[model samples]
Target: MSENPYSYVESELPRLLGNSSVSGVYKNKPEDFEVIEVLGFSPEVVEKGQQHWLRIRKVGVNTAAIEKQLSRALKIHPRDIGYSGMKDRMAVTEQWFSVQLPALQSMDWPAWFAEHMHAEVFPGGQVTLLEAVRSHRKLRRGVHKANHFRLRLKAVENADDLTQRVQQLVAGGAVANYFGPQRFGKHGDNVGQAMRMIQGEFQVRDRKLRSILLSSVRSFLFNQYLAQRIQSNLPYVNEGDVLILEGSQSYFTVSADDKDIVERVQSGDVHVSGPMFGEAPSPAKGRPAELEQHVLDQFPALYEGLCAARMGHERRPLWLRISDLALTWPEETVAELSFTLPAGAFATSVLAELGQFTEGEHANSTE
Candidate 1:
């Protein structure tokens, strides 16, 4: 393979690599998880009850499509429907949405939903009459808590045992935080477009339109970098370790060993994450390695994202974890798993692991 072009600026990259110290360690209108809550938030498993938050599954339809359907069905603004994250449409996806039909509480949801739409309702799903403020409250974004899930894929040659491998990282705090290539577009065409626009290469017959598109392109590229970090299992700087931050020129690779700052970085309490998207990839033999360099070259920012799976690393933030997985099958595949997670994690992340992941077909969705 070739060196991933996605990397930090040439002059900015570190000269050599060594073992990093073992460290502890959304979008739309969605707010971020609270600094304290994220580090310590972990909800206990619970049985279904009244007023419980629930997720509804709508297979086949994409997020955009579902949003349109939802808006039309309730005769409400598409904005009125709230979801914490966007589910993919081509594959089956489960999304959390609220509905308030006072008189319909006693009605059968399976029949009612079937009559109104084409998707099937799965178990572990919740349905409750919507509270008045729910309509006005923009569905909170960032997972209130996400349940991390594991899927074991077979068909691996001795060379590649991807299954169980991804799961092993969970114990070591290696999150699948990588921004998939989708964020970069094909060969990073979107990033390239933004580069041209940023360099003033675009014709301005319609300045406003051009600016908006260019901005979106930049954001996508950034998201790509973020995703790469998540996938790599980068370590957060903490306690005895050293770290660098590639901010503006004034603070390039600024290093410090302060425990407080390092811990803050590890917890992601003070600093969230930044994009390594602007950089190019590396010349490497494997997709995973090339991607790692793409992020590592970014350093500190991607640094946290680059930490690999190791023994003894504590999964911080008490992030999402699924235990007691029971796939119920009498009439349908009803997956019952206990979830304990931080306040801002995405439950869909767990669904993504279950396979057949799909986002609803909602055009207004801010995925």
Candidate 2:
């Protein structure tokens, strides 16, 4: 068997944007990378509620650090704090967090936190409270609608044709959806650690840590499957493709005789998806199945380990659509970019196609 073409790190992965010539520096400072979380629905404040949902903007801090600070300040258990997703540690991010306070206790914690933020007392970085609401339920994972990114790439080199590259991406409408390097941990070590855990060499007692490892393994395989499709020059809409409905998780398999599959894909009514491997058999058949199996065959141990762990079956779209993409150059060597992506998509994946980037000093830390 041939060695896998896709690397665990995202930058080494095949780019659908063609040649990778542009080189730049990423996240030079916290201000250079900004993300604004957009929650779909507004939570109403209730008179008798324990959950305090707060929207906060933090510079140079990860989501968990804020949760820990809140727990310490409120004298509550760490589990009492909840968040939708983990925001990057080295960036300026605005996100929501919910703290479950005692229903009978009325301490005005939000006001207290806002004051502390203004006082700049927190150790990690500066945090400012944007909005706060009282609710009865805790915030859950994957609840955010989307994230808007504002990025500034410094010391950009060989970017004379950057505009044309962005145009090509805009004309193509989508980029190959690969998990960001952050997902695989520093230097893409999570997948290797997951394999050790699978082989009984590493024992993980923490449930959260165990889940992260499993997820990394699954993500690695998914990237491999997507890479194979791209390398083969396969069209997004193809026979036996498992199509995911637009704006939904629901999916259905298309038969070879399905005449309208192309139209549905082009109309943005559906998307071609790749297997999220687990114990359950893949619904893909024909060429799609062949492609998935080819990837699975390359890593039988990883495949069997996932099955033994009984990971849930899921599907992620093979293509990611970039929305409201805009770019501007502040100087000859500096580029500013802004775009919005649906929840669970990575801005780094989009950036990988635009240029090869070296992480700035602070960006080396884990989120």
Candidate 3:
């Protein structure tokens, strides 16, 4: 690994890290912070319709918070409230959850969710529980629009230079798509730990969780590969840019130099590209390009996201193309704010763009 590991030596018996191992897994300090808000609204009525969703500005709080409270006058498991995605705990986010209120009709759904979830309505109307239904496959992962973010950086120097760079890129529509700093611990502990576990470099007690964390490590490296690409300034390669599409280990290159390919990749049609990890990557190459081809074929947009991620992490672009983020910044003295980030991006990337913040003296802030 190119960096130091963040995990503490447990008398030398290393284990996979959790929230505890990560010092301030979420960054604190008013100076090196940024805030992003997520807000969504639903219609005012449960009018019989095919749509079955209620948008909120927050996530991960659990359906019970909203559903149980409503049960103050009814009864059911919060899980009965089918949510499309899990959101951040700190940010004000909006999303949809399904209700089984098919036989009942009520004009009072808004008051119930607001009073229960403590979420403020941002748009649409109210919690519109659709009365109609549609036949479709059961909800799967990554099915909704992640939260959109707004960020502000701290310790900004040469703002004009940074702004000019971003404006020019936006005008020409180019940005380095790199993984955010979150991929590496202040050092590279997260990466190291995940790598060891995946390669059977350690003696893990749990087979299932160990496997899951190993997968996360693979995902992290793919981001690293993309990050490196962004840092290399290859997104706007000669002619235009190059989208290195990976399927399994075989890479098929797409010349983004063409304006249309660039537009589709940039406008969210096709996310940027990065290595696809079929198996764990060696430490030297960061396990890049070991990706499975069949899987990559499914997420065409993921390639584009990696591209943006590469750029976002490298240049620390301000105008975000990411759909979700959770940030904290100097909104006021002695006060810190928190929120949730959707899957596929980093909150720290948002902070890096807001401004460069030196790691504070606090132990928690170090990671």
Candidate 4:
């Protein structure tokens, strides 16, 4: 077996605010990190429907584990359990889930779940049903609009310095949209697995697991490209860059001479995009394209494997805007931060710009 070309090391990436002397600890307890899922649209309600939508608040529980519990209690196929995205097992998080039952059939699901899956009796952690509604549609992944985060950093080495860093990020209104450590799995074994899969060392028959491994490959490549862009001090936009319109996925390439494009980017109407690495050629041109190609050439196995697997081309914004960012000192050695991030963005990315933070037990994962 060959050495994996991509070894995800968090320290290797440059922080926008540079290194800080401050350090802190987070996820020390379940309450230290909280996430609330924001849905894009409210599920349509019906008196009796095949789909049951539930809003749940859970503490120190894996989202998948909850799905299994529901499956057994409801006696439904595991595939019938649907969630927008995975929430961290170590944090206190509230998110939605959907279970499909026979059309027009009903059972007192809330009471059933309350009796069988209450927080006190739940095996691994606590789960409380917040709301229940009947809907015609089953919840799907990536349907949530955003995630609101409340984080408390304990044992802060230098709260004042951390405050300055937060100010810097708030001023910029954005941070590098790096996929947090969660995406690569523990110690980047996911990327290593992807490499092995590419070499035919093994095959992944499970579709969900397969998608994760492939996504790790693509995320790894994007991080590499973004890291180089930061190192080179490349502007978010450059000639031959692909720019995505705000609030939409539609994107188009632009030339350096497109003077109006720069103003738009500055106004947050368009964002510079980076490749997700798939079968189609990268839409980037000029310097951006050159930098991306440099990153791709170093990972032949990953690139070729993704193409062979037929992953479609996609682009993610190079910058993630932080909304309603606020910070407060709760104690001499503690600081709290609250912010809202659009769907698919990681809160840890914001914390990365401030100081070195150590996680407690299971607190490192994102919801």
TM-score of every prediction relative to native = 0.44, 0.94, 0.49, 0.95
- List model 1 lDDT by residue over 1-367, tens digit each: 2254433221122111212221110111111111111212222322232122324544334455555666686577755555565443323344455443333234345564566554343222222222122122244555444433222212222212222332443443333222333333334354455445445577446654454444344344344444553445654432222222322111111134343675544444433334322333222223433543464454433222222211111111212233333222122222222333333333334433333223222211222
Off by over 4 Å in 3: 1-52, 59-81, 99-108, 118-140, 154-157, 181-193, 199-212, 230-272, 279-343, 350-367
Q: Which has the higher lDDT value, candidate number 1 or candidate number 4?
A: 4
Ranking by lDDT: 4, 2, 3, 1
Better of 2 and 3 by lDDT: 2
- Model 2 worst lDDT run, 10 consecutive residues: 1-10
lDDT of 2 by residue, 1-367 (tens): 2243333655557878776778898898889999999988888788679988999998888887788788887789988898998898788999999989878877565579766554356556788888888899899999899999999999888876677778776775678889888788876778888888888997999998999998988999999988888889987688888999988989999896889888888778998999999999999988999999998999888889889888877999998878888889989999998989889888888888887877897685456
> Which portions of model 1 miss their true places by more than 4 Å?
1-54, 99-111, 119-138, 150-154, 159-176, 182-188, 192-257, 260-272, 275-367
lDDT of 3 at 134: 31
**Alpha carbon lDDT at 86, candidate 3:** 42
Sort the candidates on TM-score, descending order.
4, 2, 3, 1
Query: Candidate 4: which stretches are off by over 4 Å?
Result: 1-5, 362-367
Cα lDDT of model 4 by residue, 1-367, tens digit: 2254566667567876788888988999888999999996888998777888999999988688789888988899988988998898878899999999988687776688769888766556788888988988889989899999999999899777988878876886568899888899976678999989999999999898999999999999999888888899877678898999988889999975688998899789998999999999988898999999998788877999999999998999988878888999979898989999988888878888777888876655743
Model 4 TM-score is 0.95
Candidate 1: C-alpha RMSD to true structure equals: 13.5
Q: How many clashes does each candidate structure show, in the order listed?
A: 51, 0, 47, 0
Q: Which pairs of residues collide in model 2?
A: none
